[model samples]
Each structure stands twice: as C-alpha cells, then as structure tokens.
Target: MCRLAMKTASKPFSPFSVLEAMEAMQEGYDGSGLGLLLRGLEFAEYKYNAKDPILSGIAHSEAALARLNKIMIEAGFELKYDHEFDVKRQMIEAKDRFKYILRVYKQSATWASLSAEEVENRLMLTRLALRKDGEAHGQDLTVFSLWPDVAMIKEVGWPLGVGQALGLDSGRITSRICMAQGRQNTNYGINLYACHPFFIQGVATMTNGENTAFIPIKDWLSGRGFPGYIGYQSDSEVFAHILHYVTKQLKLPLETYKHVITPLKNEELAAHPQGDFLRGLRDACRRLIIDGPNAVIGTLPDETSMLVMDAKKMRPATVGGKPGEWAIASEMCGVDAMIPDRDRSKDFQPMREHTVIIPPDRQELQIWSQFDHLPIHQAA
Candidate 1:
C-alpha cells in the first residue's frame, strides 16, 4: 500500500537494486502491481539523445501501434527512432500483455524551432488522442509519460515478475533514478493507470499512504484547464500533479510544495517570522491542501528527489545513504536492503515537521521545516 523512490548519482545502475528494495518491503504491499520509472537511462540503444520526446506505455496490438504512429505522424512529429523493449522475460499472466513498447520521437525539421513548452503540448495532445482512439476502437492504449530522459514500465503482478519482464540486470538496464511501487490495493481497482510512480512532463511521484482529501484536490486540479489533469486513475496521482502545479505553474520554489499540501495550523505558522507569507500561501492554495496519513516520494524537474509526510506522520519513511547517493523509502528495511553497508546509526526519518530534499549526484540533504523563522520558500 506504499510507494518507494531511489535517486542515485547521475551514473546509471541496474534497476535490479530497486527491485531488491521493493522485494524487501513486499510484506507492506500486495502483489497487485509494480510500476517503474527510470531517469538517466543507461540502455545505450534507447538512450535519450536530446530533449526529444520519449513515450512509454502499453499498446494492445501491432494495429494499435500503427494507429498511434499514424496519429503522431499526422500531427507533424517524425519518428527519429523506435525501440521496443524486449518482453521475452514477461513471466506473469495478466489481462493484457504490452505490445508496441517504448518509442522516442524527434521533432520534425519544420517544428525544430518549437519551444519545450510546445513540444510538451504536442506530446500531451498526442497521448490524449491515443487514449480517445483506444476507447473508440476498443484498443487498450496506456501512455505512462512523454518527456526527456525518462521512461516508465508498469504491470499488474508481483515485483519480481515485473522486474524480470523488464529484463533488468546491471548489464542490460541502468538508470540514475528508478521508482517502483508494489500495490496493496487500498482504494481503486487494479488497473494499469492506477499504478504508482505516476508521471507527467519530467516530474514523477509515488505515495505510500492515502490522501483523504482526494476529492476536493481532484476537483481543484481538474478545473485548471489543462488537458493533462483530466485523469485521476490513482488518488495518489494527485501528489505528482500537485508537485507539477505548484512548482511548474505557480512559479514557486520546490520547498513551497511541502507548505501548500501540508501547511501548518495558524498558530504553528505564527511561530515563523514570515508568518504573513505562509498564511497567504495557505489561503491562496487552500484547495490543494491534502489530509490524512500520506507520505510522498517524488522527483522535481531538476531531478532532485523529495520526501515529505503529512502532519500526522501516519506512514513510515526512512532517509539514508552516503554522499552522491541517497534513498527514501516507506521502511528502514528497504533502505538497508539497498545500502546494507551504510552507517545504520546515521539513518534518520524526516519528522512530520520537515521535508527531505536530495540533489542530483550529491548528498547534501536539505531539511525544510514549517516552524522555521524564515518563510516556507526560504526555509530550504
């Protein structure tokens, strides 16, 4: 019922380690689903070349792949390269097997000068089009994410099988950041989209607990006029979107996300010197407030990994590792599984009052607290 994310140095390491960590925490989650998100992929053949859009998801059949490609071509995107992942290792049975795997598309010469925002818009629309077409034609098309340097793999089964199907080995697959979730089936049906490590644009997130404030949060986000906000397959997906909304759209610093979603009470805010700013932030983004025992693990656009918990600290989270490498998980055992030789004495969990931030390729952890004398944005 929880989610875990591992952010390492820029160097690529096999996702096998992530799978191992997930396995160590298997008792905490059901075998319903396993979701993987990889950044700084080491699979040279499918390695990201530029800001080109890399689309990851499932296709029902070869015909569905054709339809997806046609939709992209008609929209003016040219296929610079297409590489389907080797699913020879897919050992588990499921309602649907993935066909027509990962594809990376380059912008056509005509649209070569397009801005990153334009490319993102095109990617979102193309995904939406594919989903719509899938519905109309009875095809199953699920797009996990479309962005640079990131790819997602998800399946409805145990972590071991999902990892095997991915053919993950130190030699075969590697990434700087890999997030995997072993589903426990708390709120929704076992659907592909409901899997953890939900992603949008370049940001990704996975959660270990429920967001009791899901309904209002969903309503508030859906009204934002962004087509990408339409789907809420997993209630926890809102954490990812909220990260996107606050950091991307609201033009706020990353630490502000912790403040908006789990703001302190008025009395607690009064303890800070910049209480006025904190109060204004709470009032402005009140609709985005999240309630209950939730722990969120996510990556920012800059590739920094974040860990935060709600005020109640209902779920377990441990942060540990040496410099240039760090991991945040729902349990200390998961961290121990990944870095068994690390100093366990130094291992620490973020108190409900602090948010943990790990920068890419570095281990200078920053702790942002609500009771700090500085404003929330300046707390980090």
Candidate 2:
C-alpha cells in the first residue's frame, strides 16, 4: 500500500503540511521513500525569478556539482540564484548522495527568438542531456524537474523524517500547491528515480497502487516520439506522462483524462450521453487504459489538481475542504489532518465512475462522473 496527499490553496502553504497529511495515514505505507512536487512557489527569491526555470535534483559529489555547472554554462544557461540543502547524515541512504540543488537559470539568447513550445522543448532537452551525461559518466546526478515556479524532492526515508532532513519546515520552501507521496516498496527495489510525484514538463502526478498495465502503457508512450517519456523507472510514472499526452499533446479537455485512462465499458458507454465520442476515444487509446487497483493524484501546469481511480476503484481516496483551500488524499483521515476545519459533510469519495477536480482558482470543487452529461459543481 501507499499514501498520497495533495493540497491547493489561494495562497502559499508549507510543503510540510502535505507531508503531515500523508503521515496521518502512515499505516498504509511502509516508509520506503517520500516524494514531493511543489508549484506556484512562494519563496522570496521566487518573486524576482519566477520566470527563470529551476533545476532541482541531487548531486553525489563536489565533482558532480562542478560538472553540472560547467555543462549549464557551456550550454548558455546563466545561473541567477542557487540554493543547496546538505542532506542530514540520518537521511543518506546512499553514501555518495549528499545534497539537493535548487538552482535557477535564465535561458540562452536563442530562447528569446523561439516560440513558446520551442522554448519548452529546449528546456526539456537540456534536462534530458544532463541526466544522460550523469548516467554515462557515473557523475551520480539526478535531475527531477526543470520548470519555472516548480520544485521536486525525492529521498528514501519516512515522510516527516525526509522533510525534516531537507529543512522543508523552515518556512523557506512553500507553494500554492503540493503533491506528496509516502511510498510502500512493492514491485521494485528502492530507487530514487522510482519514487512517486513523477514530473514532466509542468505536469506532476503520484500514485498509490501497482500498475499491472505498465508495460503496455510505457510502450505506447515511448512510441509517441517524445524524448521525455524515456524514463520508466517507476511503472506509475506513466500516469503523469499520460496526463501530459492527453492535455498537452492531444489538446483534450482536462475532464477527458478520466475517460481516456479509465474508459467506460462498452455497455456503460452505450448509455452515456457522449457515448459515440467516448467509443472512438476508448478504441483509439485502448493501449493507454490502466488496470489493477490504483489511485492517481495529479497537478497540471495551470495549477489545477485532480484525483482519479482505476475502473476497479479498489484504492481509498477522498477530496474535501473549504473555499481557497482543498485537499485530495488516499484516505479521509489524511484530509482531516490537512484541513480539520473543513465541512466534513461535503467530503467526496470518488468511485469507479467519478473524478474530483479543483480548478486553479481554488474557489470551488467539481465532481465529474462518466454517467453524467456534465460535471456537478460545488461552490466554496
């Protein structure tokens, strides 16, 4: 079992809050690892450098750090601000991994002349190159995310312990939205890249159950001709890539994500108001459909957050809160831990036919069902 906790608010909040929610449901996870993805940053430096992409990752040695800086400079990326967190001895699962880097960089001059999509592609390519160089040369560097106003951290340890080790509670690292996971080692050995809260471009996601359909899903995504989809360290990583594929590549509406990943059955589709459209979608994207017991919590580039389940709905999940603050978690107790003052009566537990969505505004909650003609909205 694993636990997921996601929180979004009208203003910046501490990442520790998300971890606290996950810790409240620790019984479900084994404490094998903890992963976090933060968006809409509120750090003091962020106010001045919000447009600069932050390269966040781990470096094993001073040589590795120097090599990374050299590469970025040669590539024309100018470093504007840098912050490093020296990992506590107790949090070091690998002796070589010593610190985390949150370095902000201004793109090369060429970026000024390129289209928005071209600029994004350039950033992704640079990150991929850095990751490949590290692996090939044994530099022991791992870059998790390189996007503006976003940061990611992953380590092999208990939730609160890892958070404390990284000094996340010091009130310096905060965001308007945070997605975190307390991982349970199940199908694979403990690997940092395999941790949850997987991110690509600006899309981020974490999962709580095994993806029996991982192989097919990975294959389909790898064949999409996107270089960023190459890393499949964690089977659940496909969830985030799929989300990016549907929303960004395919240009589909966010609500259609639930339909593509957990499509309605043929019989159920026949009765849906959008049956004809969903039928074509299901058939066209059949390879992306997920199986087994899984619950996914994710955030998009626009700051929207969502929680969805597999067709089986075998995993526990819920969404609840008040205006300007909302949370989606794998357990109701997790929600209670995050927002105790919330209206408990309005708490929603999504089933096989439902998806819970919180828009970027943070002013309302939406529950979209496959069986309904439209989503049901609940005002804050």
Lowest lDDT block of 10, candidate 2: 371-380
Task: Provide the overall lDDT of each model, using Cα atoms, as 2-decimal numbers.
Answer: 0.77, 0.85
TM for every model, in the order presented, reads 0.93, 0.95
Which consecutive 10 residues in model 1 have the weakest lDDT in total?
371-380
lDDT of 1 by residue, 1-380 (tens): 56575746656678878888888888887777788888876555655674777778888777777788888888777776666556654375664664736777775666668887787787777777777787677747777777777888888778877777656653565778888778735576667778888887777888888888999999999998988887787789899999988877877777788889988888888876777888888998999999868888888656798888888888888988878777778888888877777788887788877888888756667787767654334433
The per-candidate count of clashes, in order, stands at 1, 0
Clashing pairs in 1: 2-208
